[model samples]
Target chain A: MSGNILEVSGLTKTVGGGKKIVDGLSFDMKKGEILGLLGPNGAGKTTTIRMIVGLMSKTDGSVTINGRDLDEQGKACRANIGAIVENPTFYEYMSGYKNLKLWGRMAGGSVTEERISEVVSLVKLEDAIKDKVKKYSLGMKQRLGVAQAILHRPSLLILDEPTNGLDPKGIRELRDYLRELADEGISTLVSSHLLSEMQLMCDRVVIMEKGKVIDISDLSSLNAYGDKDQVAVSISVKKGQGEAAKTAVSVLEEVTVASHETENELLLDMGRDRIPELNRVLVKAGIDVFGIESKRTSLEEKFLQLTSGKADKEAN
Target chain B: MFALLHNEWSKLWNKKQPWIFIGILIVISIGTAFLYTAFDTLEGAGTEGDGENWEVTLELENEQYAQTIAESDDEWEREFAQDRIEENEALLAAGVDPNETNNAVFLNEMIYVGTAFITLFAVILASTIVSSEQDKGTLKHLFVRPYERWQFLVAKFITVILFAAVMLVTVTAVQYLMGTIMFGTGSFSTPVVEYGMGGVITTTVAEVFPQKIGLYFLNMLMFVVISFSISILFKSQTLAVGIGIFILFGTNILQGFAPLLQDYFWYPYVFLPHMTLQSYVVTDEFIPGVGLGFSLAVLAVYAVLFLGAATAFFQKRDLV
Candidate 1:
């Protein structure tokens, strides 16, 4: 058997007479890995998650979960998936414990009381589990949502914007829990517009734009310590020497001036081997360079660059 | 499937509306019993001769019905007076007090009032079952489970029926307790005379009461299906309930006009006039030329169509 838990290929969704909401999207999720579906607004991230969980119909393509085709073996395929699509909602009048029991029963099979308590404690909701959900804060409700999703120990747990309304501590707790679940070999697919959170939580990210996959990158590879062919270096010079430094860096043939960090700082994209040459050119132009450091591309920067580049290409 | 049904059952009992409805039913039923007891006592004190001699009361009531039957121009009025005369004569001969405050009589009255409220509550419950889940956005949690879409819909449909059954039993128990407490338990073997088109149909309270309850549920099933279909077709609980209640109360008005419309070929096929399943039990025919078999068959067809449409729509529509 392949180690992958979910394999989606050539997935397409068209709505309202041919407006393609999701177009030719394909990706795979491995066991014990957290795959982030990173996208801007209206990037079909939610649409893809909805289709994977079978909440929305896909116009074309096949979704196979743990080697079972979703179309032919839908019951078996969906049995392995637990999802919280968009925002998780429960019967507000019911206590959190009752809500969990209610959904646990709906999940089929006899869910023991121990399992219910286990999930409650796993989400750190033991104290608040007896309280009605209407009294729960957004963060507590989010924790309850995650607890319910993982109750059955589904092979693939899909969360769409699970951290949307969480406070910092709640987000951290969720991240820790997801990591712990991954340690036990449960795959998770989380979709989010929060790029930084995705950076901290996901192992690999599939970035999408305009109903299509733009890029897929390992989170470690996007970090500064990971291998990259080129790096953007930020040079800090004197406050008033910024304009002169820009002109000197622009005159260089190999390096591209990426952005100005501030009046005193200049950012440029070039190889590490040419940093000394660029420094010599800046010094020759009478610009005082105080400090030079290589800046790693953040997930946010990469996301903006990739999506904006696609938007530019489309416009062209 | 059992698990899903159990989950739905939990969701329903946890809500405030069902309990509130039960509370209201209990209050109204007990209050009505108290009022009936008080009125009967006062009327007995006011009429000295009639209270002592029911035979004299029956003779007077029979004479009045005979006068009405002779003077009435309307055919239905004459038939109604003639039936009342026969019913009163039978009660006089059997030594039964028509005005007695007994458990059987209270039960009969409660069922009459309870069935109306039960129908309203059943419609409200069925109309909101699916739509309320959609409104609260809990359907996503449910649909993601291993069950098929049709299974979810069927679970909800079965839950509504179970809810109706629960409500029926609750009403029966509450009314039974209150009736026994207020008025002594009357003889279940006592025969109550029902005025039929052919003549007086006599049956014991035990036999007739259950049949009325059965017919009540059957009538409720028709409304439940209609409201369930409306719930699936529309996401707004207000719209579903409003249309359901409108159809429910509107049918009374439609029945009034049914005689004029019965000449039309499609009159028997129309579901509203046929919803009066009680008419089949008490009278031979509610609508002219429409018997109990015909009404039941028409309602059965409507029930199937409503459920079929609901399941089909719910299966095909995207849960967005």
Candidate 2:
């Protein structure tokens, strides 16, 4: 069952100042899926989320949350959505517990004090929840913010830059908590410019740039390029014979070669499917081969390749 | 609505300014009464030096007493002189007249004048009632709730009204207490000024309680309407308060110098002039072209226009 909780089609917004902050953006999150919205700065991620939550009127297109039309039945539609926009502005003079309780009341029938307590525990803010929000550290405030969003048990949760200003440990904890939330069958859409964190946390990612969706892929697919088989061939020859092997491997059509003059080792980067052919070719070319191994790839390189590849393709 | 009322009541009661308003009312009412009574009592003292016309008449009577003592044959003149002296002494010894009390009038006047303080509080309290939430970026949280936008606007308006009522009641109570203590509780009544509205529309001061309450209610109502609109429009409490007070008092300041622009500016609604519960006490007959009712009607129209505008704009406003 493709249980899509939020389906936004052709969503666009032009602010009063005559700028198109959101342009033709469309995406969805399935039940039990955590979709990360990744983009660079000024990429309209916040604007898209705001439009989805009905905090903004779209200049064009429609957003349906849990199949309720946002414009025709705004309050009813928004009932199924919980969003933590920006800093999650709360009454600072109030305690975190009071703030959550008030938000719970605002969230209506689905929320209760017991649920508030549950959310606080979910965010690991049980100890500081009683303290005034103004006294909270940045990480604690963010955790409290998340607690407020989930207090109502909204079927769809949208968090804009949820892990911002958090330390690494806090970010990890937040990621773990979000995963646990998704495990309970809740749908989440988290936006961030940090691709690395997005790779680790999101079940899937919708890549946006310049107010438009450039790509949407599951985590496996987004990082698929990184995990592609690229066998690293490390070969050691007699001293002063490394250059000859590098020269010989350089002529191979299916492989790229690199050599360290002092180390007497040459590394051959070729696809696994092509590796056997290249090895046969290298043996035929009279290059001495010593060692061969594969190294783990990185999401950063994959993201760069995807974005840059798209840019190059567009240029063509 | 009940939850909204509870929140509003809590915020109002938690503040200190309401008590301060009561304190001002008590101090001014008592102080004015003591000063006015002292002035009246001192004025009743002897007709010494006999310079003014009334004092000259008393001096002339005293001279006649001296002449009768010199003649002495009838003693009737002497009796008359003794009677005159006793009458003047009695007049000098009498305290202020209880019937002609300006203390109540002055206390009521003080209440009218002190509305500026209330306006100041209204500005600060109601200005960012909604906008500040937007400014601090909290409005999204408010909007995502199940409540309709109109309910939020109504909640804010209700809160402002409650605060204003609390201030009015506390101040009036304190002033009433002070008036009783200092001016003596002999009578708490003003003589009914009978004025018929028309041939069949007969009304008196005693019968015009509705009109009086209506006028008080209207004055604060206008303040509420104006403050609510301006606060929503400006989105800054300080600016709303500053502008609201300015409009309330500034119009009066301009009206005071009406000789310069009275023709151009046809008397704007001065908040102080409309604050009195004694509408008849301060009524002015329309002189040829200028009508008091015309200005009041204009104010009434403005109040309606402000409320309509507030509802239209606030209801549609995106919380951001």
Best-performing candidate as measured by TM-score: 1
- Estimate, for each residue in A71-184, the C-alpha lDDT of model 2 and write its tens digit: 888888777777888777777767888777667766655677678777887788888888878899888888888888888878888898887788998899889878888998
How far does residue B79 in candidate 1 sit from its true spot (Å)?
A: 8.6
Worst 10 residues of 2 chain B by lDDT: B193-202
Best lDDT goes to which candidate? 1
DockQ of all models, two decimals each: 0.78, 0.46
Q: What is the alpha-carbon lDDT for the whole of candidate 2?
A: 0.67
Clashing pairs in 1: none
lDDT of 2 by residue, B194-277 (tens): 222211122232344335544666666776678778877766766777777776676567545655554444444443334332
In angstroms, the error of model 1 at B285 is: 2.7
The weakest ten consecutive residues by lDDT in model 1 chain A span: A307-316
Runs in model 2 deviating more than 4 A are A16-19, A222-299, A309-316, B4-109, B180-187, B190-214, B257-281, B284-297, B315-320
